[model samples]
Each structure stands twice: as structure tokens, then as C-alpha cells.
Target chain A: MTYEVYVNVLPLKGLLDPQGKTVHQGLNKIGLSQVADVRVGKRIVMHIDANSEEEAKSIAEDACKKVLVNPVMEGYEIEVAQNA
Target chain B: MTYEVYVNVLPLKGLLDPQGKTVHQGLNKIGLSQVADVRVGKRIVMHIDANSEEEAKSIAEDACKKVLVNPVMEGYEIEVAQNA
Candidate 1:
């Protein structure tokens, strides 16, 4: 079976996000002042071959922990669905 | 009312994502070879002040069109939720 995994890696709360700040400033400059705050993150979509959804999710989590996510700066959430 | 909006900006299908490719190769090098494919995109989370959920979503879409997304090369999806 193949599972489609979506992983969102976001900056930890209380950490400064320079890219988000830059975008916020740009939005304000462009007259979108109603945008109070912005946070920018990464979305990673992956296709994995595994026997079951649980196995696919586990593989994704391991990949995130080992290579995709920066534990000191970011946190990740994963969602898995069986690919049709 | 305040609304939390999530905007996902992704490369259009058939477009090459260099970052995704790099990460894919890294995963393979790390022995997660079961990963078949990967696509990387951007997630933008915003806090907006608006009169209603519909209004908030409209504002976010407008922002995406004006500054956040490149229509020719990328596509975007917006999700809105009322902030408590």
C-alpha cells in the first residue's frame, strides 16, 4: 500500500520568524494593515510505500525527526491517508 | 472578530520543485528509500481582524493574489477559522 503524508513544519511559539516578519511588513506596506500577524512555515508532501497506514506514518515521523525538522526551532504535524 | 487563516502555496503540478528534490535525495541517502516522491511548499498563517469569517477569507485571498502567490508557477489554498 502507498500512503500520502503531509507534514507541516512550523516555527515554535515564542521563536522569532524573520521571513514571517518580512512578509508582515510587506503586507502592511501594501495597505493590508488588517493582517495583524503572520507566521511562515514549510509544508512537505510525501508518498511512501508501506504495508499499512500506521507503518507509513511511522516512517514519515522518523524521517521528520532525523532529517526534515529542526527540533530546536520547529515542530511538525503529520497526516496520513491511503493513496487511491 | 479575529480569524486565523492558513494559506498554502505550492508549485503547480508538473513544475519541478528543486527544494523537494534536494530533500528527497537527502532522505534516500539517509536510508529512507521507501519514500517515493516529495514536494515542498510554503504555509502562511495569518491573524486577521474582520467582521465575519467570509470577510476574513476574502481578505486572505486578496493578499495571496496581490503579493503571496505567483499565478503562473504556483497555486494556493486558503483555510479560514474563527479565532477564540
Candidate 2:
């Protein structure tokens, strides 16, 4: 089976996101007044080859722990499509 | 006009992503040996309130430069849809 994985990687709350801050400042410079609270993180969409959804989830979760996310500094969420 | 924006946030090349490394390790531990590489990032989807696609892109780009991303550590890609 094949699965689609949506991954969100973000720095933990309270951590300094220099990138987000810079982007926020840029918005003001460009006169984009409506943009409020710009926070930046990574979004990854992947197609996985697996035997089942459960197996795929387990693999993805493991990948999240080992390579996709740093539990200490970042958090991640992974969702696998059902009946796909 | 309203626009649909798809944003991808990622760590710059050559930067160490501890989170991505951890997720890679987790994948191996979970018996997902087929997984090759795990790079962590953020994905943001937003509906923009704008008068035109060009305006929306400008706004989104400004946001990316100021708040959505750190120019030093991260890179962002924003795609605004038309005919929506």
C-alpha cells in the first residue's frame, strides 16, 4: 500500500525563531499590514511505500523520532490517509 | 480576490537539523529500513484576503521575508493560486 504523510516541524514554544521574526519584519517593510503573527516551520509531504496503514504510521513515527523531529527542540505531527 | 497559498519551510542546506536526524534514527528503530532520508520542515496553507493574485503574492512574499522565515537559517516557498 501507499500512504501520504504530512509532517510539520516547528521549534518548541519559547524558542527564538530568528527566521520567523525576520519574516515578520519583512512583511512590515513590504506594507503587508494584514499578515498577523507569522511563524515559520517545515512542512513535508511524502509518499511512502508500505504494507498497511498501521505499518506506515509506525514507520513514519519512527522516522519522526529519529530523523524528522528533535523531541527536545521541535515537535511533529504525521497523518496517514485511510482507505487510499 | 481571495487566494490559496501553499508554503514550504525548510532548513537551509549545510545547516544541521537535529530534528531531522532524530526522526531518521526513529525510523530505523521502528523497522522502517526502506526509508532513505528524513528532512523535517513546515507546511502552511492559508487563504489570503487580497484584491488580486499579484497582490497576494506580494503580501505572502513580504510575510515570508519578515515573519514566516528567517533569512539566515531557513528558506520558504510560497505559491498562490489563481482562478479561485
Candidate 3:
């Protein structure tokens, strides 16, 4: 079976987000100060071949640990479902 | 009301994703070639004050067009909901 997996990686809460900060400042300069608490992250989508959703999720999580999320700076969430 | 919005920005389909290609190649070399069709994108979360969901979504999309996404390099989707 083939599963579609989605991973969302973000800077750990409470961590400084320079990129987000830069954008936030830009927003303020552009007069969109109504927006706040901005955080930037990565969303990765991929297909995995596996026997079941659980197996696919495990594989995706393993890959995330190895290359997707940098533990020192990031955290990630993963979801898996059989591809249509 | 404060709305929580999520924006997912991705390289347009059919555009070459060098970052994703590099990661995919790395996976193949590391013996995890079962993963394929990998695409990498950005996820941004923000809080916006708006009168309604539609208003929040419009604000979020406008921000995406103005700064969150580079039209030449990416496309984005925005989702808005009342924040708890």
C-alpha cells in the first residue's frame, strides 16, 4: 500500500524565530499590525510504500528524525493516510 | 475576535524542487528509497483580528501575496478559524 504523509515542522515554542520576526516587522511597516504571533515552519509531503498506515507513519517519523526536523531548533508533527 | 490562520506555501507543481531533490537523493543513498515524490514547502501560522472567518482568510491571503509567498517561486493556501 502507498500512504501519503504530511509533516509540519516548526520552531519550538518559546524559541526565537528570526525569520518570523522579520516578516512580522515587515507586516507592521506595511500597516498590518493587526496580525501577530507569527511563526514560520516547513510542511513536507511525500509518498511512502508500506503495508499499513501505522507502518507508513513510523517510517515517516523515522525519516523526520533523521533529516526533516532538527531537534535543536525544531519540532514536527506527522499524519499518514492511504493515498487515493 | 482573534483568528488562527495557517498558510502553506509550496513550489508550484511541475517546478523543480532542488531542495526536495537533494533530500530525496539523500534518502535513496541511505537505503530508504521507498519514499518518493517528495515535495517541501513552508507553513506559517499567525493570529489575526477579524470580524469573521472570511475576513480573516482574506487578510491572511493578502499577507501571503504581499510577503509570505513569492509568486514567481511559490503558491499558497490559507485556512482560518477562531482561536481558542
Query: By DockQ thresholds, what CAPRI class is model 1?
Result: high
Among the numbered candidates, top lDDT falls to 1
Which tens-of-lDDT digit does each residue in A1-84 have in candidate 2? Answer: 667666777777788777766665666577776555445667765556788888777877766776667788887777777633
Q: Each model's C-alpha lDDT? A: 0.92, 0.69, 0.87
- Candidate 2 stretches with Cα past 4 Å from truth are A82-84, B1-6, B9-31, B36-84
TM-score of 2: 0.58
**Candidate 1 C-alpha error for residue A19, in Å:** 0.5
Provide the lowest-lDDT 10-residue window in model 1 chain B: B75-84
Model 3, global lDDT:
0.87
By TM-score, the best candidate is 1
Per-residue alpha-carbon lDDT of candidate 2 for residues B1-84, written as tens digits (9 for 90 to 100): 567666887788688877767765666676776555555667754556788888878877766666567889888787887734
Candidate 2 chain A: worst 10 consecutive residues by lDDT? A33-42
TM-score-based ranking, best first? 1, 3, 2
lDDT of 3 by residue, B2-84 (tens): 99999999899899999888878877778787897788999998999888888888888889888889999898889886673
Per-residue lDDT of candidate 3, residues A14-68 (tens digit): 9999988988889878888779779999999888888888888888888888888
Q: Give the lDDT of residue A39 in candidate 3.
A: 92
Q: TM-scores of the models, in the given order?
A: 0.96, 0.58, 0.94
TM-score of chain B of each: 0.95, 0.89, 0.92
